[model samples]
Target: MSAGRAQAFWLRNLTAKIAAIPMILTSLVIFIGCSIWTVVYSFTSSRSLPVTDFVGFRQYERLFGAHRWSLAVENIAIYGVLTLVFALTVGFILAALLDQKIRFESIFRTIFLYPYAMSFIVTGVVWQWMFNPGLGIQHFVRQLGFENFTFDLISNRNTVIYAIAIAGIWQITGFAMVLMLAGLRAVDDQIWKASRVDGIPAWKTYVMIIIPMMRGVFVTSLVIIAAGIVKLYDLVVAMTNGGPGFASDVPAMYVYNWLFERANLGHAMAASTMMLLTVLIIMVPWFYMEYGRKNKN
Candidate 1:
């Protein structure tokens, strides 16, 4: 395209470009500008307020050294692994079952996807109450004359993170199912017919052909879930509040406590920076795979 053609094209879309300017500026200022500000401040020694005193990587060193921060990292690691495994597995299984052309298929899909429509806070609160020993499943089961049953996962530090993972899975698995179902639906019908005509079992067909074909959907769902794991805050707050002695403290909660509770802007920003780095680490490769490879081709 020549400069004249580009200029003419711009003029042709001038009104659309003018309308997009506000959205573009908002993204620049709110997302890019704020991220830059956060990263810059993370290198400072600001306490309670922003400051110009550059402290190198001292804040980050302190952040990594903190036991609470370490525990938070560990908890998130466990939670992330568990949530990714279970959510995707269970979601795919549910989607596969529904794809069998079962009766009331729409109702089943609705039931599975209903939880995804709920806010994390609501899911957290509901799960929190359900995990309450005195009033929840434990009590109800004991009332059934078991009398010695104990299911206080939320109260135990050793298993609180797992408990959180359970709740997170419950909320997110539905979303994964919907995505998987869409991918399944998008599969060429002739593929299924060919598989059946070849005398291949359904399971073998899905494993060898269908799943491999939904590569984009799987990658997309995995990345989305991983990103959610990195930003896990509100659910923790609503469920356990990182309780059982910070056993379930995730990085987001760690940053929040430092920023608001401890009044340490630099420390908070350092943690936040690490989180942003983790997200970039997850996203950059995906962007390269999705766009860079296509462009190269």
Candidate 2:
């Protein structure tokens, strides 16, 4: 607390502040600069690498004309809905079972959740093989004298999107279960007593009373799931490669292909821009309702 010591402390902080400027600058240079660059490139008729000349809205015209683009948008909706429903249901059931004081809680939890920790590349590959017809679950089961064993959804045009959803659910449900179980565990023990005293059966109590009490947890889970829906890419790439005539193509894959593969920077940017807008349209209101309006009320 001497004057000399206080002066030294302020000097050290000042020097540290000066040192932090370069770090901040480096981050902004990468993040903000690249984002602006993407937006700029989106307005031009650049291919491969970005060019200076601009073509306003022409790229948007070509992008909308592409069947792949349209299919991708549709595929995202289907994948999002199927994954959300199945994952939430399976996760809830598993969580409830695990929460019932099972004999091997840790083991069961780990088994379910361990898949979520694996890289999507690995999950996509494993699932791709498992759903493949000749060398996977189908092969083994078909040999068991069930001659018409069919699990080739990965290659089927009508069902390829569901294959991606299956893989997604396998990887994501465990995490969702962990969330639901945590929410369920946090419910007041008094609620269980109240339900019992009111002559409510356990199943009815959970469905009618307890699950409703965990609305916040459910909303949070759904939001997380929704984000995954919007940015879906890697698994579809590894598993289906958007094959079987663009059956499982998604916005992320479309943007990536335009940006890198075909070098259609303008269209790529347009796709990316549209994606950003779509996410905003979907999420802004939910966020407003959940956080903004709640505060106002």
Considering summed lDDT, which 10 consecutive residues are worst modelled in model 2? 30-39
Per-candidate TM-score against the hidden true structure: 0.93, 0.86
Task: Encode model 1's per-residue lDDT on 13-104: one tens digit a residue.
Answer: 78998999989998999899999999999999999999989999999899888999999999999999999999999999999999998999
Candidate 2 off by > 4 Å: 1-36, 293-297
Residues 1-297 of candidate 2 have per-residue lDDT tens digits of 699998887788797779998888877887577767877888888887779778888888988998889999999988889888988888999998998889989999999999889888889999998998888998999999999979788889989998888899899999999999999999999999998999999999889988999888888898888887899888988998889877889999999988888878788998998887787787887888788857988
Q: Measured by TM-score, how close is model 2 to the native structure?
A: 0.86
Q: List ranges where model 1 is wrong by over 4 Å.
A: 1-14
Q: What are the lDDT figures for the candidates, one per model?
A: 0.94, 0.88
How does model 2 fare in lDDT? 0.88
**Model 2 residue 98 distance off true place after TM-score fit, in angstroms:** 1.6
How displaced is residue 30 in candidate 2, in Å?
A: 5.6
Best-matching candidate per TM-score: 1
Clashes of each: 0, 1
